[model samples]
Target chain A: MSGWTSVLVGDPRADRMVPKTGFTVQLTVFSSAAMAFLAVFALALSLATERLADRWSAELARTSTLRISAPQDQIAAQTEAALRVLQTTPGVGSARALSDDEQVALLEPWFGPDLPVASLPIPRLIEIVEIGDGFDATGLRARLQAEVPGAVLDDHTRWRAPLVAAADRLRSLGYISLALIGGAMAAMITLAAQAALSANSQVIRVMRLVGATDAFIAGAFVRRFTLRAFAGAGFGAAAGAAGIFFLPEADVAGGFLTGLGFEGLHWLWPLAIPPLAGTVAFVSTRTAAIRRLKEQS
Target chain B: MIELERVAYTYGGAELFADLSMTLAPGSFHFLTGPSGAGKTTLLKLCYGELIATSGMVRIFGQNTREMDRDQIALARRRIGVVHQDCQFLDHLPMAENVALPLTVSGRQEEADEYLADLLAWVGLSGQASQLPPQLSGGERQRAALARAVIMSPEVVIADEPTGNIDWEMSQRLLTLLVELNKMGKAVLIATHDLNLIRAAKTQVAARVLRLRGGQLQAAGSEL
Candidate 1:
């Protein structure tokens, strides 16, 4: 922090050599703010995808469902037999049959709330909770086949793998978006600094004539551009966070877009954007100033 | 405090001058007189380390300028004063700031206040301190440039055509200030084409006149 203050509080004597207000200043601030605003969405998307991957991996890996499709009189016996096989397995923690109302509610999104569970010839579903390493689905299926002949065990591997892969890919894209935003900000500030250096060529020559070091001349520009980026990014981060705050909450009706935001303590991440922008501005402007000065000299 | 030994300069496929040797010792006053395109300004630039000699050697304070980098040259310039022909300045700045620029660039802003008032008074520019460079007349701008040059109390003062744009009276006033600086034990080198200004300066100081012509530096023997 002290180092930051030292950079921010520059030598006023040298800084006064160049004019403070110009088109470059406005260009730097506006472009940095715009980039920071977009960065917020990228960050939200990344965090949301991460949460989705974790939920899918944890929920599907630790649980399985046993389905009994047999004759109406034989369905009760098959469900009991499947539950006995699951209880005897090494990794099985608890197994229970889902109630008709619970099963109907599971299908309610597609079939409506008034699903006729008793009249239809539907399979019975046994919810299996895994403890420790969880049961071996292949061995459990063989046991159920021999004992009840119509039961199947589903550990959700086939569906869970693809969903988790898609979520992971989306998270990577989010990170790539953030990198592009940072790169764009650096490039824009560098061009603006180059223009300012060209415009002040005479001033720089005079400064060199008067015994000003390259560091002294470059420091003025670096400090100004860095502060401008910091201020602009501060405003941008605040506005973006506020925009995210007003988004619709994630409910049963709402999907991924509604879930794309910070939750609880994750809200603090946006506060870092201003300093990050300032750092980017400092590096880019310093590089540009030094390179331009070398060419002029 | 500046030495040029057997120096030659060529530009645009033409040799401006060659085998030019001159030495400016402490408290010496010298005048460099030449016609237009005779490399008078170029010689002054070589004296101040602004231009490296194409051949031979130029040294400042006994250090060869050819061996010095830009940073070393800048540090050495703090000990020398240069007043350009056009009187260059940051036009956006006021006259006072322009005059005190040497101190400001050297990180001696605190020293500027103590010396600025007296320097401006001495140069007779105190009344025009708040005016911008564009607002000042030619003579006033030259005076401001001189003030900036001498604000550091350098060991050597080099001026290139300091009176080209001003009348005779203003030219004498500027000469008197340079003469005063010379009396304080500083080397003075002025490059100009005006013979009368050289005559005027000869009356006040024991000055040597050198002429650059036909690719050689020759001593002008009390002709004017």
Candidate 2:
């Protein structure tokens, strides 16, 4: 704990021992900023995809559709019989047959305006909402088969499963992208740190001759690089959050493209990127510094 | 105190020196004289825990160099001040900060603030405290290096060619400061090829002279 605190609250005199101006400084800051910007996008994508999966699963899982296809005279009788059966089921919350106007409106998107609901032999659709554990599909199907010969029940299991799985895979991909970004950032920072150490070999030799410990020497470089990374990452995260905030608002017509951003308290997540980048810098620089100092000895 | 027991050092595939034994006791002054590539600097490094002897033991302040980790060596180094021929310093830092570095590294910066002015004054570098190392003259840089070396008040002082780059006057001044340090009961070991400087030191303090040649260490007998 004291080590960590010292890394944060560095010794100014020791810090002054290292040259402040070098290409390695620019490299560390630039790479951290760029990676942090990319990380923000990855985090947002992961979270957005997760929310999409849950929303789709919940909305689709709670409701089902029953389609009735019969002789024109028997269609109403079969829909009513399906609705009646649904009403008596233990887990069925509500069931209603779509009126002609409602069915016309539902089909309008596919069939243009003023869809001819009465002229075509379109199947009568009854929407069923579930409650508690949800009604057993097999039992409902068996009863519907006995009471209504042309009725078929769809619990949305096939559609919901595939959609949720795809969304989950996308979320995993987003998280994997985040990991890759972090790894690439670490590699870049390590290279930059090694370059700085090599450039300041004289400084290190002087410090060592003056009885400076490896921890003291390493702490100087670690603190410098860590603060650089933290500052750069903070800037990058702020820019990214601003970019995300200004994105087009979520719209039903826009669908997936519109919903690809932070929602509500999720805005707080990107705040962690700066500290995480600082930590990565601290670990990578410290490891590289210690190893280099050992080799110098 | 530092003790070397039949210490041997090898560079690349060949042996540089072997069966080299020496002891640096408190308040003693010794001069190591050798030709170029005679392993004087390497021996000094071994004495300070910078390099471990390949085949023999080097004990600094009662701890074996082979047995000590890097941190332990570093801690032991705090008690042994070393002055390099090149007078190494952090070029970017001012002279005052560079001199105070020993104390800063040891977490004794407050003591530096107390005695730094006095230390610089002792070396006659009080006016050049804020100047960068690159701006200082050779003699001034050497003095600064001396100041830095002794700022920690180490028990033993090892200097490699302390007067190699300066004129006769500056060399004497530097020698006077080192002689004063010896008088204060700090062990001093100087490695140099300067016979005149050795003769000059002998008049001020009781000093032993050792010569290294052909991978052997021999005590000099009235050669100076």
Candidate 3:
């Protein structure tokens, strides 16, 4: 042991070793890069889910519904009276009874377009848009119950709760997926670093005997793995960006997955992945290298 | 200085040496002559704090090897230089780099240029300073190892078969360097099977020759 003055030792030249096992390096990089890429996508999904949930919940939060049903002649009369009542109520932004043509159009997707919507005894629909913090839906329902005797208030709580909960669940799932990807990247990089360290076992011996410290030896491997991870992550991120770029222009798929992709300056979020991968590799490789060195003595 | 008292070493629980006792003081030169598998290298390892004795005490610079932590051992090792038969080198690095490695690992890299030059010149390796370790001849490697060993200006220099793979002329050159270090007040311990080199060194320095054989250590001429 060149009498222990040096605390670091390893194949300092391993950086120039050019990696004879390119396939394994590639395999490891691809595995980590893919996970990171998926993580980027999951992060984007979570953010988008938040935005979507907020838009839907904010727009629908306090809105109530009015369904009027009576004899054809009385239906028009009751709908007019309900609109008048809502207009006079506090916190009601605007109340409009759906026209016969509008009601037919709403049903057109399910029923044939040629249906005579005016002749059917279908309930007259009135949409109540609320813009204030508080709404007296109970009072309005009571008024309609006693006066119109054919009107019911639907405050949208039943369907709105399930929709918001589903969106929240999706956002949570996205975050969980991102976390798992980070874990997998760490594991793969650790394995690759261990393999490289073992391959140069004799090199480590020479370095150790020459007075190189555990830190110096560990630093060389950490730099190598961190740089490799960065390179691979850059390539993967670029590929992901290009793939997302050629995605069908927003109008095509009607929504969901297409809108699920990034927009505007938000596209820059995935760029952090390469550096993140490098950090992961740096930490994992360091831990693994130090553990191996300790085991050697 | 190194002191061993009732020390024993084992690998896989097989004792290589038992209850060995010795002390090396400043400016003293000692030759450890032993048969094969006599644990000469192992004993040197204990002396340098590379290996801890399984039983009893092996102390260097007044600190027991068994009690020294890794960093403490490394700091202790700065005062001791060891040259091995294989002459381990970072083959990718130049001879100068390999020699300056001790300074580098100790974070004294700032003085590598000056000290490295002096070390290479002393070892007669000035010409091979820029060459990679693999490019050097076997004797050159041994010389480079010696250069690396002494570059830190150690108080004690230990060699495990420093002449095991060299010519007679190279062995003499190495022995001359070890004697010079001893004269400079550096304690020297060399383990070798070469009786010729031992006899050569015994004349120049007040060298005590000890032999390890059949799991027992004795003075060379005690049996005679």
Candidate 4:
């Protein structure tokens, strides 16, 4: 932090040694801002993906479905037997059979709502909500088979595995995108610093002849570039946050793409982008300036 | 004070000067003269620790320059003012700012106000203080460079062809300023091919003139 203060309130005399670089200043600021703006989206994506993965893992892991498929007259008897077994099982919080209307609503997207559910020999579904650690599917299956001959236990492993895996991959990709943005910012700033050093070779030689140390010379450049990055990234972060704020509400679409934004307190995360960009620029510019100054000496 | 003992310099497999030895004691005045490409500038550079000798030793203020790092060399330069032949200046800055550059670099910018005004007046550049280096004539620029070189009141002053671009009157004026600094106990070394300036300096102070020819330094005849 003290270093930041020094960079902001540098020795005015030292700053005078380096002339104002016109286009390089604009180039550094523009690129850093653009990178910071993109980084905000990457951060949002990573956070959103993480939230989705957690929801899928927690909701799916705790619940299972008991389906009874038997003759029309025996289905009710088997479903009743399955519920009785589930109630006595440890870790089973509650067991209730879904009504015909609820089942019809669930299948309305795949099948027409006007289907004759009563006339069809459809299987009965019993939703088993788990308590503490959730019931063991293997033990539950064995018990259901002995009690209700036509009952099947599904723990949702098949559905949850691929959804969670995809979410995890998306989260990792988001992080990689952030890393690439930071690396690109550093690379661009380094090149700009090198150009400024080369263009001001005469100033550097004169400074050296007048008894200025390499650190003093390098500080002038580092401070200028770091401040530019900070300001530019600040603007970029603001613009990015605004863009996210104005995005269509997640409830409007009820899709994954609509959820690709920051949640309540998560919005504070993008505020860090400016300082992080400033630090990157500071390190990159300092390294480049010192190396170039050493070479000249 | 500066000392060079058996100092040799080679650039691209070609020797500029070898076995060169000299010392500038306190309050001493010396002149280095040579024809074009005779290594006058190279010797000045060695005295100021700008270029390390290929062999032997060059010491400034009793410290061997070979052991000094870049920072140490910079600190040493603070005590040794140098005036190049071309009179380099930050072209964007005004004459007053350029003349106070040594003070500014040394973190003595506050002291610049008082001494800068007097130095500019001494160099007859008071009227051109606000003008940039590019706007100044050759004589004015040379004067400005001299003011900058002496802003720190360095113990030693090394000028390479200080009067190369100026007229006769301006050369004399620059020489008078160098003589005045020598009188004030500053070791002064001026490298020039102008024999008239060397003779003119001799009337003001006792100066040792050394000539460099065929890549060697030797005492010239007492022609002046």
Candidate 5:
């Protein structure tokens, strides 16, 4: 086109430090900016899932149950019998009936602090923690079913399986989202670069007439677009990182769902979004620029 | 050498020619003359590889135009130089850069520093090399265009309406330079409407005069 369009080297010599242009620089920048913003949430989601998984695994590792609900006169005797069985059982760490205060606290958020326990026949609650492979859940359940009648064993693995699987799926989904974002950034940058090239058709013809190769002409466009994308995404990422810093994170006693923000080593991961955006922009714009120039020839 | 066999070019459903043929040996000089809209510039473009013939064959240096890729066409173009009527240049660059463009594009910018300065001086615009194209007068621009065309020392030099925007004295000066290039073994093909300039060029060099009229090309009679 023109000398201005030829100033940027299309494909710089491998050993040379000269910068070259690629596919779609502006598109890359836009995609990077948008993706980087999304990537912050994905990364946070992944870290949160890992924590959720750990919490489920640790809390449910070795636990069983013994529920006792019988006739009002028989209730006291059955509770005592289940406690005696738990104390005598091998590998049992501890067995105790949950106190009224503990039960009230667990239900406080939903059912309020007060419960009409004397009017309604609420089943007695027991908590069991076991040591070293714990008591066999099936064996304990059979004994309680005969001796305590209303008693049931809960190893917690059934609920834990679904919870952990959901968390793991969320983590994988976050990674997939990050990949899609990167690809989208590349595609967007390429499109913007093509637009710029088309707009400068006269410049291209003049340059070609004067003997510049397609690579040289395309290089100029690629570099300009690449620089623009990198600079734009860098600004976007800085803003995103700053925004993440002020997000609300759940503290102690809150459910796993409330803790949806960055924690510990996870904070540093968001810092990499800017540079990753830049790399994607560079590659995408370069490819598009070269391809366009080749097609023009 | 350049050759055309029953060549024709069409644009926007308008026919410029149907059966035009011409040949130029090395070191030959020819003037293409026509009234306005006579396809003189179009014929010049065909002479170079800028526009391929719509039908028939146009060859440069014995290679068919159909066989040339962009790079091949560019390499072939390096052996030829073209000067447009408007003298297209990168307005952002100075006249020296403009004149040295052919060399620069050919990856021979290194040889331009001395040759370009000398060429600019020969064209009598040695003082204008550092100035931008827009800053130059019409006469000065024409001379710069001439310098740019010949800077590569190409085998063939094609000028389309080179002196159209300049005065008589300036036009004479440009013609003198073109004639000098012809003496240096460069085949010169100038497309113009000025018969007086053609008459003046014939005195300095043995030149052929061709006229494009009525969708056909013919050798002009020696009447001017």
Candidate 6:
């Protein structure tokens, strides 16, 4: 078999050459488990932020608003004119002026309920839903400025841009966190493998004396650490996934914090952590073993 | 077979040995004798491709030691069984597994299984087979080291002080084993301070003895 295949398949006799118990074993398992657990959380954070960003982008992109700020006597006239202008506008799916009660509810979070809205000269608000590719905001603004002088058109671009950017940045941070976790795990595994190799210097010498190739000697360490990382990461990922599952269900009222869990096939992402950890361990341990063997030689 | 032509070794900017020439033809027997500071072990390491000569060609199985990479040296080492004075073994492994190590590393575990039992018995180590190396007495460790060295049935056996720590009777037993191996047509080279052991071997096998001192190698004449 090829050297890599032999490393993965592992010879029991070859593995027996290394001592079964040592601090490196525990260190590798613990570090892999801890890193994998963190990686699962990072993955969830990335996926959740991606979902949030998309939802905000898509929802905000599909609708806009119009506000008519005018004299008390001219409010009705401008609202009617704004609605008429929007109706004829291409790509404007529908437009409706908000009822006083709806407007009051929107303002209730900042201003307390039961506010006297009719007594106050509040600006009239119009909700515009878009269809297909949506209306060109510049054209719609020009039309509203010409036809309804007191009306202002908002395409929600200003608000959506920053919110989506923030979420996108957060998603990127999550991915960066995952990468850091992977890197940290690799570093820890490398150190552990180096320590194990140093501790087993006598073992290495004997193996070398007995005609063990560097590949065979290194395969023993790589196989052991790889399996440990795999097993540890498996348990860690399962635990992390379980923690995410038991989190409070996503609530529209609870916002992004409540939505921090895998959805559908995204759950499969954590399943890859163990194998990825195994691969990292394999590479790192192999590198460390080969380097140490060369130094010893 | 192994050969060294005008081989010289230096350590820490000082020449340990120079102008050394030797050959281990198939079935030949030779002994290397030297003072404590002499570079006998270093010369043996050159023969097995463990150390590169400072000046001259040291070839193992016809390949120059200087030109062989670590992997190539390892491959060549498989054909050269080496018994160290300290009898290095994987302490965690049992005596049987330790003896079978050469075959195991060579991916010939089946051959190890075939030969391990009889080999252990031949070395008078059958009773200690299941015990660990640390648990074995000095003599048993020496015998086990010899068994391990020959497990692959290497072409030549290079041993450095093979009986360094064992009793006289145990040393004689180990020497007899080496004699039997030489009779079987395997070249053998041993380095030791034990002139008595060399004398004992000369009686049974036509052995050539060489001495290394003051960075020079010379054939010993009537030394014993």
lDDT to native, each model: 0.90, 0.93, 0.81, 0.91, 0.78, 0.92
Question: What's the ranking of the predictions by lDDT, best on top?
Answer: 2, 6, 4, 1, 3, 5
Off by over 4 Å in 3: A1-32, A249-252, A263-265, B222-224
- Please give the ranking of all candidate structures by DockQ, highest first, separated by commas: 2, 6, 4, 1, 3, 5
What is the per-residue lDDT of model 2 for residues A221-262, given as tens digits with 9 covering 90 to 100? 999999999999998998888888888888844788678899
- Candidate 2 lDDT (Cα, 0 to 1): 0.93
Scoring only chain A, what TM-score does candidate 5 earn? 0.78
Candidate 4 residue B152 C-alpha distance from true site, Å: 1.0
Model 3, global lDDT: 0.81
Candidate 1 residues B35-137, lDDT tens each?
A: 8889999999899888888999999999999999888889889989989889999988899998889898787899988999999999999999999999999
Q: Is the docking of candidate 1 incorrect, acceptable, medium or high quality?
A: medium
What is the DockQ (computed on Cα atoms) for candidate 3?
0.38
The parts of candidate 4 lying over 4 Å away from their true place are none
lDDT of 2 at A196: 96
List where candidate 2 sits over 4 angstroms from the true fold: none
Clashing pairs in 1: none
TM per candidate comes to 0.95, 0.97, 0.91, 0.97, 0.80, 0.98
Tens digits of per-residue lDDT for model 3, A8-96 = 23344434322345354775678767876677778778877877788679877856778998888898889888888888888899889
What 10-residue stretch in candidate 4 chain A is worst by lDDT? A1-10
Give me the overall lDDT of model 5: 0.78
lDDT by residue (B76-95, candidate 6, tens digit) is 98999999999988888899
Query: How close is each model in CA RMSD to the real structure?
Result: 2.0, 1.3, 4.0, 1.5, 5.2, 1.2
- Candidate 4 collision pairs: none
Select the stronger candidate by DockQ from 1 and 6.
Answer: 6
lDDT of 2 by residue, B1-224 (tens): 89999999999989999999999999999999989999999999999988899998999999999999988998999998889999998888999999998999999999998999999999999999999999999999999999998999999999999899999999999999999999999999999988999999999999999999988999999867
Positional deviation of A104 in candidate 1, in angstroms?
3.4
lDDT string for model 6 (A157-193, tens) is 8899999999999999999999999999999999999
Winner by lDDT:
2
